[model samples]
Target: MSELRKTPLHDIHQSLGAKMVPFGGWHMPVQYSGILDEHRAVREAAGLFDVSHMGEIDIKGPHALDFVQMVTTNDASRLHAGQAQYSLFCNHNGGIVDDTLAYKISDGHYMLCVNASNTEKDFSWIKRQCTPDFDAEVTNVSSHYAQLAIQGPKAVGILNSLADKDLSSIPHFCFDYANLDGIDAMVSRTGYTGEDGFEIYLSPEKAAQLWQSIMKAGEKDGIKPIGLGARDTLRLEMKYSLYGNDISGETSPLEANLGWVVKFHKSDFIGKEALLGQKETGIKKKLVCLIVDGREIPRPGYEVYLDGRNIGLVTSGTKSPSLGRGVAMAYVENGLDKEGQSLQIMIRNKGVEARVINPPFYKKST
Candidate 1:
C-alpha cells in the first residue's frame, strides 16, 4: 500500500481535536471545531487552514517560458515577474487534466501550484515534455514546502503583525518570496474564497510557528482554525469548482464553463487545437449552476431533467448555509443551459423543482 502523507501541522490539528480525514492521499483535518462554526468564522472573521497537501513544482532556466507555453493553454509571455495566473492543462482532445496556478517568480523561473491528486501524473507529464533542447528543470517541491492560509476580512492586519515586508503593495494574484519571521517564505494574495486573503508557503519546519504567530496576532479578530469541510462550502458558495468532483481528466474547460482559463492566442499549447475545434463546433455538454426549491439537497450524481426529459447529472451540490437554499452544479445538455431556465433534480426518486441561475448563489456585497 502507498504511504499516506501528513502535513507539518498535523500535530497541531490533533492537539486541537480536529477530525482528521483521508483526502487525496493525505491525512488532513476535515474540521477543527465544527464545519458550520469554522465556515462562519471565515465569513465573518478569519480562519486558518493547513493546505500543505497541495503540489508545487518549480521550473527554472532559460527555456522556462517556452516549456510553459507548450504545456498550458494560457499565454505565459504576458505575465510579469511576481504575477500569478490561473491556467489549465489539457489533453489532445481538449479534455482537462487540471486547473493550476502559475507564478512567474523571476525572469526565467516559474512555480506551478497544482491539485494534490494530480501531483505524480503532472510531474511525469512535465518530464516527458522536457528535453535537453530546452535548458529547464522541473522539480517537485511539494514535500519541501508547507502552506497555510489566513483568510477573512482582517487577513491583512494579521500578516502585518508577523511580516516585516510591506504587504499593502502586494496586489491580488501577486506574490513575493521573502523571509517571514526569520524563515524563507512566499506569500500570495490569492485564495479559493472570493474574500481577500493570503496563502503563505514556507519550509515545513517553520509551519507550526508561522501558524501560531498568525493565530495569535489575529486573536483580536477571532481567528479560528478551519478545515476542509468549510473550505468546500465556502468555495461552492462562490461557484468555484473543486478538482475530482466538479472537474476531472475526462472533463474539458469548454464543458466546465472555464474557457477563460484556456487562451487561444498563445502560439501553440498541448490542447489548443482541440479546444479551438470545440469552440467552432460548440460543446455538447456544459456545466451549469442551479438553485433547488425546498429543503432536499441535490447531491452529486443526482439526475437532472428538463420537461421530463433526462438532461444532465449533478457534479457538486450543497445546502448553502449562507443562502439557506440548496444549490447545485451540474453538466447538462448545452442547449438547455440558460439563466433562469427551469429544471428538475431527482432527489430520492422524486423530482424536485430547480432553476438554472447565474453562478455564485451568494455574491459578497462589495
Candidate 2:
C-alpha cells in the first residue's frame, strides 16, 4: 500500500490532540474537541482549517486564456485579474473531470485549485490538452504552498489583526497578495464552509506559524481548530457538492445542479457538444436536497425510493448541526425532483421518510 502524505500542520494537529485519519492520500485530522462543538463554533463564532492537502496548478503563456477556455466549462474570458470563478473540467462525453476554482492572475497566467485526490489525474489531463498549437505551460505547484481557512462571522476581524492590508478590501471570489503576520501570502475571500472567510496561501515553511498566530489572535472570539468531520457537515449544510460523492467522473455538470458554471454562450469547450445535446434532449436525473423526516441520517450509497421503486441514491448526507435535522444531497428522477416531493431512504433495510427541499438548508442572517 502507498504511504499517506502529511500536511505541514500534521504535527500541530497531533499536539492539539486531534483525531487523525487517512483522507485523500493524506493523514488528516477528523476532529479536535468534537464534531458538533467544532461545527457550532464555525457557525456561531470562528473556526480554522488546514487545507494544504488540496492541489494547486499554475498555467502561464501567451495562449493561456484560450487554453483554459477550451479545457474548462466556465468562460475564462469573463475573469479579470485577481478574480476567481468556480469551474469544471469535463471529459469529451460531458462527465466531470473535476470541479475547480480558476484564479486569473493576469492575461496569460492562471491558477487552478483542485481536489486533493484528483491532483495528479487533473494535472495529467490538463497537461495533455496543451498541444503545440497553444503556447501554454502547466505546472503542478502543490508542494510549494500550504493553505489555511479561517471561517465564520468573526473571521474578518481575526484575520484583519494580522494581515498588513485591510482584508475587507478583498471582495468575495477575489484575492490579493499581502503580508500576513510577516509572512508573504495570497489571501482569497473564499471558503467551502458556506460562511464568510478567507483562504490563505503561503509558503509551506510558514504554515505552522500562521496557524498558531491565527489561533492566538482569535482566542477571545471563541475560535476553535476545526477538523474534517466538522468541515464536511458545514459544507453539507450549505449543500456544497463534494467532488467524488456529490459529483464524479460519471456525472455531468448539468445533472449535478452546477449548470450555472457551465457557460454555453462562450466558444466551444471540452464537452460543449455533449452538454448541448443533453440540454436539447433534456436532463433525465438531477441532484436535489432532501430533508429527512426523522433522526435517521441518510448515508451515501443509500437507495432512494419512490412508489416502491428505486429511483436514485444519496450522494452526501449528515445530521446538520446548524439545522438539527438529517439532511442530504441526492440525484433523483427529473420529474420527481420538485419541492416537497416525498421519497424514502433505505437505511438498515428500512425506508426512512424524506422530502425534497431547495438547497442551503441553513443560511446566516444579514
TM-score of 2: 0.99
lDDT of 1 by residue, 343-362 (tens): 99999989999999998877
Report the C-alpha lDDT of model 2 over 197-289, residue by residue, as the tens digit: 999999999999999999999999999999999999999999899999999989999999999999999998999999999999999999999
Winning candidate number (TM-score) = 2
* Clashing residue pairs for model 1: none
The alpha-carbon RMSD values of the candidates against the true structure, listed in the order shown, are 1.1, 0.8
Q: Global lDDT for candidate 2?
A: 0.95
In order, candidate lDDTs are 0.88, 0.95
Write down the TM-score for model 1: 0.98
Candidate 2: segments with Cα more than 4 A from true spot: none
